[model samples]
Target chain A: MPYSSTIAGTRYTFPDLRTLLACASPPRAGDRLAGLAAETAEERVAARMALADLPLKIFLEEPLIPYEQDEVTRLIMDTHDAAAFAPVASMSVGAFRDYLLSDAATTESLRDLAPGLTPEMAAAVSKLMRNQDLIAVAKKISVVTRFRTTIGLPGRLSVRLQPNHPTDDLGGIGASILDGLLYGCGDACIGINPATDSAARVMALLQSIEDLRLRFSIPIQSCVLSHVTTTLDVIAKGAPVDLVFQSIAGSEAANRAFGVDLALLDEAHAAVQNLGRGPDGANLMYFETGQGAALSAEAHHGVDQQTMEARAYAVARRYHPLLVNTVVGFIGPEYLYDGKEIIRAGLEDHFCGKLLGLPMGVDVCYTNHAEADQDDMDNLLTLLGVAGCTYIMGVPGADDIMLGYQSTSYHDALYIRSVLGLKPAPEFEDWLTAMGIMDAAARIRPVTGETQKLLAALP
Target chain B: MTSAPPDDDPFAFLRAKTKARVALGRCGDGLPTTRLLEFQRDHARARDAVHAALDVPVLSAELVATGLPVPIIVQSLAPDRATFLQRPDLGRRLEESSSAKLEKGDYDVSLVLADGLSATAAQKQGAALCALIGKSLSFRCAPPVIACGARVALGDEIAARLGAHLVIVLIGERPGLSSTQSLGAYITFAPKPGVTWDAERNCVSNIGPEGLPLAEAARRIVAMTALAFGIGATGTMLKEDDALAMLEGPGNSSPIDGHRDLQG
Candidate 1:
């Protein structure tokens, strides 16, 4: 059905739900590049006005991408919990936004409502929300997952110690890892984006990380962010694989562009489970998503990048991932354009992922070519911290030499944790305290005898 | 556990291990003033590198002096840097006026030097590398084309127009804080505009002083080019590992070594 709204005596009409959602979305370079954004500012507000009055059931009745054509659509339709949705089944999108912000949407209630919410529903309501609303609603929703350490706990934040190296040199990666450990980081996981996709190289990096974990007896998990196929090959060779990593997209075609699919993810999940790597919990997947992935691949099916991004969360939640983060600004200026667009995308991803019952984190980052700097990252980092984001990246000094981008640093993590009174995961906190790296108040102590031993142990 | 003396800087040794900014001293959970300024300084350089224009005349003089053909200057469909940064699709096609400059000819290879994201990289390294590869290839080499507001894929259209069998793009890589002037080379076989994908091209990145040096980068590029010609393919079908033995055999002293300290 077509939708229309009149504002300031000017009428704006959208032909379908997908077009309505696209036109209603805030300005982003990706949408504009794709020619999907609203042509005028007034038309955008008009589209939003029309979208606000949309019945929540309209999303169920009219699919954006047809159910038969897209497996992601099929998955959402097949798994939706009608019973959980009954409470707000009749509400409009704007009314649902009000409901989410009202006193009724407590932590437990949002958790129960998660299965009932579709990616479209979450996305539609998000367009109406300001940054504060996104934060306020997300802070109330607690989506916890576990592997080696508990993540997404209230009053806690985590950091993925990203010790990426240009050549995948073991010594360089080890040094960065040690640097992160001394700052009481790496509770979420110690992940590496290897320079090469060779299975042998991935195995060697995994073995080195596993060795460090064992030597320190650190309560942490390790992942080599490689292709799922390469990681599966490594796992079959009896390597210590803690988490299976993949870059997934919202559409079937886009996932195909990434050389991944649901069946492949399922196979990798089972393969990791067969290894029995995670004793703490069964959440074994670590997914990295960004808004512009589908569009960049020319497989977005005319959907806006943000809505496409939210749909990726559905794919992530199916495997019950331990970590799912949006590399918001990594795609460059083509998608996000600048700091403002990047910050909004980060908050939206965190809120959408958390609302859909996944441990969402933000790689508060930017490429040098993009119109963003460390100050913008600091703003998003503090905001995500306020929204109780599950985790953020802890690159060495926020400079990822291998990846050629700037992300939140270990010191940035410390700054957020200190100001927000957030603690690391409980198991990791205990390990830090025992190692004398972090004090009781969650402040990283001056590197002393214990940390020096860590530094000395690096090979 | 034995405590190290406070006077000794424990992290000093780690600085040599990787280019990653690690062991930066902290002042109460934030970067110390000196470290913070250092980061800001590096970031400023990187941001500036993205906007810095290519000195075409100087680069052309260097190429000509190195016994390379006088360059054909061109611009992509993107009119300016802002449009180039925001609209990558536009940067892949040749502007009409630039496209008209090429006449179809049976050249073995087309060399394109593009000011991609960081013109500083292309200006620093583009000429000498082009001369080295062009002179060594033992085949007919097209005049080098210097592209403004270009992306890597711009080489495809330029090469297709020249009727070259292979296209090698020596372009500026995205500036990172550690190295603002790093160049990258992308090689594609049987180049065709709008038909080629990024996966169809093999890339050799991080060509700078601190990363892969000029002689090694030239060796790999030539090896990959030869391999692509031999296999009739590039990208995923062509593996760099196949050329590894050739890379290990010998080192040719590069004429491009003098440009390494330009950033300093």
Candidate 2:
């Protein structure tokens, strides 16, 4: 018996100290220390011996601190209360995970555990899960989902009209918005990022979208992602402010580059709440994140990019953002290296975000400088669709001239919906029907003459 | 097996004087354990700084206590941190309600305090710098305006509204890993809303304990403001010629002209 166990036809080998040390970074080391803080001297001695073979520098980096296990244990108990599962507290990490993956009945119970997972608890529990288990958890979480803002209702997948313009060119952006509307996008928000960082330009862009919404009676939301401050300005001006947008990262420095924090998010959320926009009093903030942002900002804390990306979900959860999508492959080859890494990161972010209780999505994108292409995005999009992604960026022609990248396109959305039997958000679907963009059968129809005339006049 | 002794902290000497990540060497393929831990700690601090809220009432009271001028409260269009981050242009302008409250006045210079990326920086450093600048100027200075959710260009709007000849905006700089609570000063002449480029401003950056000492930063700012007023221009044409070497106290030897190239 070489310290191996088999369950569900897959075997997991128990690790030696060296393997444990390699996997256990300083944060996890601190967590282990805290976990054992209240134990008896004898038990502490045993735990210490188990970790004693680690490099001395690892101990120096993380000081031993007292922590409350009851907090985590209580959360787990609460989750277990909701699910039909065996007591997992007494099991070792591997044993607990193996028990969960032993059969379909156990695998189906995984979603019950999601709400109870803090990043620390998740990291600990996840270490015991295989890649397949992670995917299984994602598959479970994505089914029958909706955002806090109620954009992605059951049986529907949301889409954002990212009519990005290189300059504050209203004509180009308006045309793109029209095209996206024609193709049944913007169930999420008509979010735009103007190239120029001017206040007037942002306001003008926002005002244009507001006009479009009012004129077309489009019940969806609109956002001009200039900066949080600019969005606030638009709101204060009594202009149409549907959702505030900002790029976020796991670490503080990366967020500093994005120029946002929890306080900023709270303030924006409060401001939007005061305005009382959107359906069912929905959340009024939208956030985007990427894997390499923290590392690029030099604030990743030596953690793996995936873990750092997961920590960012904690930040997003504070704001209760209506939308949270990772621009997974947009960071290029330096951080993620290749298509394989990109796909893994996309899945990891989706799983982690869903586990942390957020409406997760993916861009399914790649830049020209990256080691990815349409095929890579295609594979990711199909998987994400099956994984129940809340939404994806709907850009024209799968190429964002402003962002300088190729991403999932409207046709791709149609393809995914056809394969997955998903529809656009309910409210948006009604608008599409009214405009004759989609028929009673939910098939894309030829552009109506009236809608074409309206689009022609927009530019 | 015999193990190697822990590598000495290469930045130990510099760490005592500055928060800059100096002399931190790599171990294997990543940062040394000490450096990595410090990085995490610093990253947390920086995030905390960005998220820290400014107690506007308290800040207003403290500025009045400094006996310079009664601070006027103003607000940028950005209502919160998220909005401020998303809308840099909005941060540069005033909210409509605030615009209505800002009464126009003729003054030599309009001093503005804005909570930029770090509210902590603005609240802690604004009053002291204002007091120091007050000592050097004999001209009528506009009552200092403390604007929340503001950026450097917000001064332009406030100054234009006040009909001041020059505007000196003391705002928070973006928090770096090492230093989270650092202040910056941006001066513009004949400041207005449109047609103002980055090249048309003068900036004094990194004013905090870890960077430029407050007294020296204040002195340099006063000198530059006076020079700009005298020359009837600011920005690329303006230069910091006056030496305030005495203000740079012992152990404060970091470079101070970091913002010289900031202008377009």
Candidate 3:
């Protein structure tokens, strides 16, 4: 039928079709299609004039797919099968928003026609998504099942215990970890970077923290921030490896220099997938990264530093890490020369990683030689808090002995939580309340008898 | 005539004039991205320099190639890198086997090559520097010794064991991002373990391609050793001003001249 009124070059006789096309992709021949389509050119030209005269219509017609919550689940399953969650998982924030708010919008139909939509084959379709997309899908798909139960959900923040020591001395390192836990910090994980890069030493340190977790019944995950291969070895040796740790960079060469690859990462992820640690089951890995790593490895291939950093996240999301931190100022002043540069990089990394659906944290640190200080870190941490950073590193007095630098202190984490009115992860918050080490407001209170007993019991 | 006046553009001026991190032009907010990446690259280089394992056999071969006899390889009391980092006191003394391997000899100067914080620095500058100094001055020089996991203090025992009147320690300096392979020379007269304090030592620092050039560093080391011999002392009792003034004449300044002027 010849029509003058048009939406996306598809002519329609009635004025309302424009609203329908804009809001709901392609409107089908409805209960009233014949009225909307004109068979005559005169009626079509008349419809265009009438459309101009008509009031602006808000496309509040039926949602793209009319379904109840369970019906949405079923359609999603029917279209993508067991992998329905893959649809919105790896989409950029803008892309996800476009999918949701588009004319073809509605959760179910978007899932059905998503970039990585799945179908059963042999008469059905097979779904193979990018690893990061699969991980992101896991988070979104998990909403219905809610399989994972750790941090980085809405309105929740977590804190990591970084009792780094130069000698890996159990007593000295334990004191720092105990201090962090007492101050309401170990919700995310208690991870250590041992000074000696010996696999045996890393294994011993991991076992020591595991012992403490058992003794205190502290329900937080633990990791040794060694190479993922080393962690895999320790795991093979029958150590309790809750999360495999590695330093990841943006490019393939950078990852190789850091002694990791997609294959190694997958193996690490699968290694811990069934451990079932943490409150929400096991998160398989923890990743640390910084900008300029790709450039350091001579593998950036001329990409901008921040873009390289985001690509690193694509590698990280595969493992579903409990914590993924950008050691913002740790690499020294050569990459991020001053406070302004460091602060900007930290924010950019946080924003990009979060949009890509990873649990993001900033080290909020600097070296002695850098043109930066505590005030710069304060500003960065507050900004990250506002931007919903998942967790941060907590060291004694913000000093890291092994790394030869300063980072966010336990007090800084407390201050950020108080200022932003954010709480630690729910499971950790419950433990803190029961231990009487923290008040309901997430403030540090005097250690009660029970808490003191737990602290004193540590050897 | 005065040298050409400084370049009108401050960035080019600073960059051409000095290796110091300065006048690195900024972009919208921070350092230009290229400069920032360069900084990171240099930082990684510096870190690699520091953690680098000293290849004793290769260093000895290089030393021998420079016409000096193959260096006697030894190690400090620290067993490994981890111990060396935590126990500085241990790196100042010789291991038992190294001490047993040492026997007294008559010599005017004992040259000791040590891998301080940066093996890269020591490896690059040590042998060539030793040849330069050895050829420039006539002295009863002992066969040079290569020490792994060594600190400046280790030079004393090596010299004392050789019965040399002077000890010149060619060691690695803690690397900065800009110059990871810069070497440092420490000269002491009347060498003895636990006898010389930092106040009793003379230092020539930043010896590399970017800092003091190799030839100049060798000349300065020879000059300092001569001065220590001419006088009865070294360290604070000896200063580089006289030598620098004589070497460059008036109004000629080195790259680190500003720092020297400040110290003065």
Candidate 4:
């Protein structure tokens, strides 16, 4: 009955729980007690308190990203289908983020009934560039996760500001969709919603994201708070911000599958010993999970490789800066989950829990599901560069590139050109000549109008 | 057999393909506990008195009455135990502004209600699940709002200021003495404001009466938010109840009925 407490100003300590209740294992009283005897993680810390009569600045959810400037202006003008921008049945539930911020998907005659080359989205982008050589000779390292995405991504969009994150990096929703998730996430990485902004709005969105990461220099990794609001905002902002706690939100909504909870390393070593100045400034609170909690995998919760090393040594025993993620998902559903055995149990729980310290991440999605294709988005982005999976979080006009631009089903637009081998890939005229959004078309096909308005904006 | 609704689909649904199934491991739903303490001494009242006697709004994101937005976060269980144990991070976020100033926010779909960890399940369904999920998404709602010092990512930071894709927070699930108001749902899809909880995020937890009930957890949170945007991603992988309980096969173990596995 003595955990530690204060009350008025704030002071509740865990200090490691009598050395884990003495090798723990007791708690199951009242209704059953799912877990909490505390053999160590330092006797499961349990109760820490200081209500100061409750409600300090608190507020919890606000924004740098929580939509409503007209549903993000109708999902930035979402074109017609692909399950109306990444959401399928239930009469297209809640109407696909307002059909991609609808104005009829940013008009321009939707690039003349686009799909660009239209010979059925150029045969589903030549069957996703010929099925990008799947299972690549069964190499199968399969399983990883400890932590990745130092910061930024899920895809096509992600932003939840209050660190001054309100709605405008000078509007136009940050050059249309948060600068394509900080320049299409090849590792500038992103994801921040720790209850929708404020810690001075996530430190003013990381000081306005280091002026777009020094003009996209891209080095933003680590931001996931709550084990007490990133340990009381890293102990009231001496400033370092690279958190990641636990509780895979009921394993992504009622067991889709990405489970493990070791109390996220005593709430990330109390948020890096109450906010470090050294020890790499604090970045290992890893152990996320997924199977469609919000969208599947993440800048963090990309989970699956199975219990990711007792969930990364229960977050590297009080946070030593571990890194584990399992990012794996393809479209949305054709029915009954697998997404390749949940990315092979999140790459076998980060390749056997990073040999004990925990580090095996591989998140991949691309999205736009309504029965996804383009060979399920180029075989899940070539299965994240042949499954080494250190990291990957997508969305930039993804949504299976908008269901291969609405193919009326030539096996869902050539199923990623016969599954990624690709004597075919690149359609909508090689993605409008790799993002110029048009021009390189020697004989591409759906020329119609600026290549079907850039294949009706991907996903 | 008096049913017709409830199967909204949680993408991983089970409870036997729905008939509004309720024999009572928990089916209390219409706010019982003596009418939830007589609707808290009344006035304006939940669903506004069955929507002023049926003018509508007696709860409708329809799963036979909003279930998915399951937040029950509450936190002050035994506080005064001397400064409530030091402060406990003050229990994350949520203070005065209450129902977060009744937001009436930019809306697309936002369901908040805080007090996390347990304030007695935020006074049981914090103001009746934000007045029944804003009267079931108020018919393509544009003004539905309610917050009370939120925190499970503050509804993805107020769903990034209401650009809202899907955010059914609810709050207050952290009490134990068996049950203090259980409730929990931290759903997310397009919901904005800093969006983190990785692997996307999803939940439709034991909503009162024990767990997973409120009209089958609002048809499992409108069928897992239409399957987290039709399976792009979300945590703990729930593709149609773990793929129909692994096809209702593999040694068929059996257990799932309520009380979240009776706590492992």
Candidate 5:
């Protein structure tokens, strides 16, 4: 059914729900590139006005990408807990937004409401929120998961020590890992994006990091961010796999473009759980998602990038992932355009993911081609810190030499932790103090004799 | 309780192993001034590399000096830097006028020098690497095509137009803070326009002084081409490990030895 709204004297009409969502989305280059954005600012406001009045139940009635064609849509519809949605069943999208922001939306309420909220409903309500609203609500809810250590607890922020290397050289990767460990980072995990995706290379990298973890007896998990298929192959060959990682997308078609499906994810998830490497090991997947992923793959099916991104969170929540982050600015300027768009998209993804009951993190990064710099990253980093982000990448100096992008540095994590009074995962923090890398006050202490012993152990 | 001596470089051993910016002493949870400025400077260079235009005439002359045919200059559908950056699809197809410049010919390899993302890489490394690979390859090489506002996939369309068996695109990679002018090579067998997926191409990346040197990169590309021919495939089906073994064979020179010969 066509939706219409009036502003001043002009009547604006949307042909469908997808069109309404696209038009109502805050200005983003990806939506414009898809030729789905509102032509004028007034048209956008009109669409938003119309979307605000939309009944929350309309989303269930009108499947955005046809339930039969997209398994993601099917997943959303099939798995929705109607019992949990009963409180807000009769509310409009606008009222839902208000409900989320009000004091009544306590931690327990939001936790219960997660199963009831569809990705579309979450995306629609988020469209009506400001950045602060996104942050304030996200801060109220926490999604904790356990692998080697507990993550997403309140007053804690973890850093994925991304010690990526250009050649997958053991020495180079080990060096970066040591550097990250010294900065009191790597509580979330020590993940590496291998330069090559060869199965042999993936196995070698997995063994190398596992060796480090064992040698130091550190309470950490390690993952090689290779294709899920390659990771599965390594696991079959008896490699020490910790977290099964994959780059996931919102739409079924987009996920297909990435050479993944829900079935493949389920297979990988089961394989990793079988190893049972970490403590509990219940959360065994690490997923990286971003805006424009569906559009970039030419599989968005006319929906906006933001909504598609929220749907990705739906896929993530199904797997009970330990870590899921949006590599926000890594897709470049074509999708995000500038720092403002990147910052907003990061907030939105975090908000949606957290609301959908997932341990959400942000890569908080940008490519050189994008119109962003360290300062832009700084702004987003601080905002995500305030939003109760689960983790951020701790690259060498905010520079990923292999991936050719800038992410949060080890020091940047230190900065956020200092300002926000956030500690690392409890177990990892204990390890840091025991190793003399961090003081009791949660500050990185100056290099001492222990630092020398740590350096001597490097191969 | 005592801190290490001030002059001792605690991270020096690790720093020697990787190019990653690690272990610069921090100032109260922030980067010290020297390290911060260094980051900003490298970032600025990388940003400039992305926007900088290729010196086509100089690159063309350099290619010609290496005994290759005169280079054909062309532009992708994207008219300018901003458009090229914004519209990647436009960069994957040639401009109408530019497409009209090439004549259909049967060739073993269609080489493309593209100003992808970083024109600085194309300008600095394209000609030299082209010379090395052209000298080594036993196959018939067409005159190199210099593409402006180009993406890696543009080579597919160009090679398809020329009826070449394979396309090897030496394009500028996205600039990183540590290296602004690194070149990348994409090799695709059985070139097809608008039909090929990125998975159908094999990529060799991080080609520069600090990373993979030109001589070593050329050796690998030549080896990969041979393996692709052997298997009648290029992409995921062609194993790079086979190419590495071929390069390490008794007769083949080491990468360092090849570099020395090139310098001499």
Candidate 6:
């Protein structure tokens, strides 16, 4: 099958006009366009190589994330009652039995059991778990923040200052995560969601960073496609010809809002199709399978893992092979013994798991599968990509991100968690200085870049 | 290095200082040893840290793979770093044969695990975590491969030539440590080179020992392979019917608050 589309809907491919504008080693537009039309697998790789030749600074996502606030406590008080799964306590007989059988309870009981077998004590333990909420309290959670504070990433870091207008154009948190990646990967980028990636918003944000990149003699990273809304509305409005996939259905918002649903992709795809679009112009990419079915298990969805795998395989067979994306999101609790089921279901059977003969592309939440270490999370994220997630959404403060300055295709994930879970990390200051990213930080330090550096680096 | 003055919290500042050291090492950063806490922080993520620490880093995955070990390394092959993101092939092979001298041997199972594109993968257990694999598996084992630059097929690539019953690789997982540096394994009933990602591949991970143990990971992989055999799969033909059904299911949901209710 030849990939042919009318002018209104061209195949999503190559460097954005901005890449053309910012190319340090500019080719004749005629040659560039000609190559694009005749792009073979090798040519695409070549174009990608040429992309890397551009300054790393150009790729930085626009408008950094200002995570460090004097008053900014990284730990949010997550009241157990407010959580969607809070009802786990008001569990039915089935729920209690299931919990008992779960790895979490069996491996590590949720309750603080006592020697006393008194009914009162036993009842208290159950009630406590039912009412339980854990807080990761610390006098200071500044290691990571200090590092970022000293050495700012390529994106704009918004200090707590409220913009004069109710909304600032830079797209804030998502922008910052994307910008840093752009600066790191130096590839063509397109973000989903209005605040994250709208064409106008993207251009606006990039344009805002020109002065900064120039001060550093680097090009501002430009978004080839800045799409907003995971809803079919944006794609129908007119998909970007250069964009490949739209990373959508994030886990946090959906998980926080409802629970999870791994079996909703088919219906979600149908909804988009009902809107009258058949991936002809461009391909659609989903990050996690949850946006459609929020908190339903795979087996509960009337299918087993293999059935889901077949459908996923079928969907990839139907969509772009290079871009066979089944987005997955993570909320850490699922891996706690029996809590492992959701993690099990949310996982998209790695095409690599079956295709490449390796297990890859299953998105489980919580940085340290064992603990919450940003760097460790970055490593796992990177490994997952290699294992075969076309992309994995990640948090901004992930350590390996800045240290190695990596953003590989096979090992890519979105860093949306950065915005929603922005917490002050103290160690970021030392990392910045050690990695020599401090000077770069001052370049786009949205507010008080130089001043913050001095204060943070002070003994 | 300055010796630490005795203090109430011996590993405190360093522990604090090394927030996500595991991820940094796994995501193509240098093999991490400095600034790392040797033991697992939560008893759940790791079964026993001191035991893991005492074990040689080189043989950790095998010990972790006691039940069985499957090693793999997957990376993009694009030659340059910039292009690797767009071209995945580059990340799959080490620039040079860093493992050529990796004591070629024959045994019941030959295993090698690489971090391929994700460096944090290798460090999720912080150290090679040989003890995790060793303490769990009480069987004759082959030597292990713990390299910085590794790939998924490398396990089979080496094993294909090794002529072993099984060849497993547990490379550094790509960093996503906050999320996880999940270990991936490649298994072959009768190992040989030229095995593609589509053929005879089986894995067991999220093996936090407590959360998901290496021994249990072994159990699952063995189960996956046994099922693959019963179905008579040849890579692409293998039907992994319900291998990963629970991860995404809400009933399988594990909330962070340490408290959760039953689904149904």
What is each candidate's DockQ, to 2 decimals? Answer: 0.48, 0.01, 0.02, 0.01, 0.44, 0.02
When candidate 1 is compared with the true two-chain complex, its DockQ is 0.48
Tens digit of lDDT per residue, candidate 6, span A166-211? 1233433223432342223221122322323335444443444433
TM-score of each: 0.94, 0.54, 0.51, 0.21, 0.90, 0.30
RMSD of each: 4.2, 20.6, 22.7, 27.6, 4.6, 25.8
User: What does the interface RMSD come to for each candidate?
Assistant: 4.8, 21.9, 20.8, 23.8, 5.2, 16.4
Least well predicted 10-residue stretch by lDDT in candidate 4 chain A: A115-124
What digit string (tens of lDDT, one per residue) describes model 6 on residues B1-264? Answer: 333333542112322322322122122222223323332233223222101211235435544455434333222233432233222233344434443444455555555555544344455652334444444333356655554333465555555444445655554332332333445555555544443543355544344422445555554444444544455442445433343232222222211111111100
Lowest summed lDDT over 10 consecutive residues: which window, candidate 3 chain B?
Answer: B255-264
Model 1: per-residue Cα lDDT at residue A318: 92
| lDDT (tens digit, per residue) of candidate 2 on A1-459 | 112333345443324322332233222111221231212333333322333323322311231111232222222233333222234334444454455455652323555554434443344344444456766766655423333224645467888888776555787777677766767778878888676656778888888987888787886788887678777877888877777888877666567767776678778878888887665647767788887676666565444455556657767766667888999877654455456667767876786777666788788886432445566777888888777788998876565655545576666777787778888888788888888888787776764675665564464
Model 2, span B26-84: residue lDDT tens? 34223456644554565556656766778988888888888967788899887877556
**Tens digits of per-residue lDDT for model 4, A284-331:** 454444323322222112211122112223223234443445434422
- Please, what is the whole-model Cα lDDT of each candidate in the order they appear? 0.89, 0.65, 0.64, 0.33, 0.89, 0.31
- Candidate 3's displacement at residue B46, Å, is 17
Query: Considering summed lDDT, which 10 consecutive residues are worst modelled in model 2 chain B?
Result: B11-20
Q: Which ranges of candidate 1 are over 4 A from the true structure?
A: B1-7, B226-231, B240-264
Scanning candidate 5 chain B in windows of ten residues, the lowest lDDT window is B255-264
Better of 1 and 2 by TM-score: 1
Please give the ranking of all candidate structures by lDDT, highest first, separated by commas.
1, 5, 2, 3, 4, 6
Show model 2 residue runs off by greater than 4 Å.
Answer: A1-92, A95-112, A123-132, A142-149, B1-264
When summed lDDT is taken over every stretch of 10 residues in candidate 3 chain A, the lowest stretch is A118-127
Name the runs in model 4 displaced over 4 angstroms: A1-390, A395-452, A455-459, B1-264
Expressed as tens digits, the lDDT of each residue in A358-419 for candidate 5 is: 99999998988888898999999999999999999999999887777889999999999999
